[model samples]
Target: MAASNVAAPLSSQRPLAIEARGLVKDFDGTRAVDGVDISVPEGAIYGILGPNGAGKTTTLRMLLGIIDPDAGVRRVFGHDRPHEIGRLIGYLPEERGLYPAMKSVEAIAFMGALRGLPLAEGRKRGLELLERHDLGYAAERQIRQLSKGMAQTVQLLGTLVHRPRLVVLDEPFSGLDAINQGKLEGLIRTLADDGVTVIFSTHVIHHAERLCEGVAIIAGGKVPYAGSVEAARDRIPAQVRLETRMREGAWTHALPEDARREGDFFYFSLPETGVEPLLKTLIEGEAGILSLSIERAGLHDAFVAIAGEAAARQLEADQAGGGA
Candidate 1:
């Protein structure tokens, strides 16, 4: 719950995991990221959510030191730059690949070696992760023989082989089946529970709703909302819907003027006076209330509200394009 009651621009938690202040990036005079600010609390799963071309990957790369930001500051593990903090963070880029001829374990161990891990230790850790992730048998197999999902998991495992403190994934769920996505969600939760800070980028709002305690919604090269999932949802008003058998005009005065009526249900915001009095009035008026429910806005609705309807539509169109 990083943004529950933000007293300042950044998180107040001790030993902050990652921070980027007014980050901006440009290429060929076109800005991909513009004035973005983010704070990730230690030991929490944070999500960077946006539509395609929303500057998520650019911001992530800036924070990871893969590409330098044209403007602003980024801090990784209390350092101003990622140079000395390379071994402290694990990064999984959206682009996925490996040596097609290499064995799975060999690929993973090779990746760990680049992160300053010894070959024997990296192999041991890779084996442990393989067994833990139910891919022990695949360790001996070549990368070319694995399915797309399995290969993606192997890449993620390689990123995590050295057990870095902060794990940043870019579109980790892309091309994964439902089962693999669920398993990855569980793996993220496990990492947080183990005191690791995770930050991932995704266009799917539901993933952030289910897995992250904090989220940043990016749109059109800027962040419109960043904080706890609860706070983001709280940005929109709750909707009260009731289905009634009696559709007569008798209950009209009891409801708000802005209420909309559908086939069998009336939908509107609950008045400040509360639902109890409204329900009582409906009952006394002899309105047959078949069903009544109050539902808070979900992450998708909140994202649309915060990030703009255009961005949401773009995300939907992007999804359709990917599926096709």
Candidate 2:
């Protein structure tokens, strides 16, 4: 691991919790993260989103100072060095493991000790965190004795022992059932409620869509959109579909020229004023409305729209191939 030394950033006036400016990384001559820039607000849940091999992990590693960027600068809490921030930030990597012989409490304390916390203090804090996470009874259990979900929770407990202000979880929802995934979502929300800035990277857009206030979509080692989640969704227009028994007439003329028609159904992009007026107009008229739906664009749609369908297809292919 490369060590990060404290250095004053050129601008100390920005109040961002995490900021990366034109970050770039290369491996064996191929760029993994190319000109990526991101700004994470304080006390917000932010997500770096992509499919496998989109360089999400590489970008995060650079920001955490685990690896130096080939170009650009990264600052967390206005400091250029992660070591300078130390216990102020907690990191949970995608690959999780624990010593089979180590007790849950002991494991947590060990992680804390690496960040300069005394054993007694670390244990005290670790117990509190474990209890808070509903793992109080399992504190003394060895890693090999706990269930898979319980062991994962214990590993997460170690990440929280020092009570860092910023927590970075890489693919935190991976390898868990839907129930456990929901539990993880709640835990993330609770952490943010305590004023901690939470940054997570995930290939699953559903998780990011539900939990993140802002997100950055990375495809092919490039960021297509970075800002509020709403902004990403707004990049593509919502789709309106009208399925009526009455198909052809003045009502059909109401649809845009680009509207796609199939039998008695009409599908088109929602107008700026939205479908309400159109619905009212149809209802006032004698058009027998069987079904009408306006499907708002989701993060996944936005990813395809902004990053291009080819990139989305490639991402899916990479995910299926088990590449990251």
Candidate 3:
């Protein structure tokens, strides 16, 4: 299936926490976000994935009401956005924000208060969250004194301290190390498990695959694919890689329709008919098939296949214009 045909569920008929229709954004005569629509169901961990400059951030900004869309309708928790957004959502922008001179605990509590949390409860929750994220020891440390990773953690904690119904995180794992990355992933999952609708943007496709139940892959200012992770994987052809200890003269041409050689192994796409025939053919051909298993397409492969197609189309259009 083509990426462009991958459809997201409709918000109007579904119990959605976030919805946008015909979203459009223009910057200096260029369409940054073009007629995009998004629907995030309640309690879902949703991902907005794309390459750099693919309008993923722009769409997110518009959704958060940080920037206005030139055209479209948007709602958060069924409330009109940019207006009622304050009551329905929490946002952690790609650019981290914290007052440099403020202590970590003070900053987090202040952020929670800004989101409508009472000072006492906000301070208590702020301390708890900081401890949960392993930033408790740094609570008294000023923002400027903390390392980059520590600062980012403080900002993330602030976003979640208010416990808003919807959370929009832009590149939440941008600068974290492996340990911190795992920690953030855990927090994201925990939030979703608690019934918070999460809409996060990232260039790291693997994180989306691991953390989100559904994802929207955007390219060239449009959503080329959007659906459940399983559905996305299903759209791509399933293949298998086989490693064998066959003699040097063994022939593998008798393999399945999409079979090819990569070093000593044979790679082939599994036909809907099954794997028995392919295995039998290899055995009959005197190929020593040591191990064989189906190779599932990873999110990286899916992104490459979908985004590459869009880029090719754009190149073709540009060339045609040049010729004209």
Off by over 4 Å in 3: 1-5, 8-14, 243-254, 262-264, 277-289, 309-324
- Estimate the lDDT of model 1: 0.86
Candidate 1 vs candidate 2: the lDDT winner is 1
The true-versus-predicted C-alpha distance at residue 164 of model 3, in Å, is 1.2
lDDT, candidate 3, 49-99, per-residue tens: 876677988998888777899999888777765555585678888877789
lDDT of 2 by residue, 43-152 (tens): 88999888887898898889999999999999999999976778798888888988999999999999888777899999999899888878899999999999988888
Worst 10 residues of 3 by lDDT: 315-324
TM-score of 2: 0.88
| Model 1 agreement with the true structure over 1-324: per-residue lDDT tens digits | 212222123344557788888899989999999888888888989999888988999989998988989899999888888867778888898989899988899889999998999989989999999999999999999999999999999999999999999999999988988999999999999999999999999988778899988888888888878788887777777889998878985777889877999888899987778799999989988898899999999998887777777888988887766521
Whole-model lDDT per candidate: 0.86, 0.83, 0.80
Q: Count clashes in each candidate, considering only residues at least 3 apart in sequence or on different chains.
A: 0, 0, 0
Off by over 4 Å in 2: 1-14, 276-285, 317-324
Which number leads on TM-score?
1
The C-alpha TM-scores of every prediction are: 0.92, 0.88, 0.85
Off by over 4 Å in 1: 1-14, 249-251
Span of ten consecutive residues with least summed lDDT in model 2: 1-10
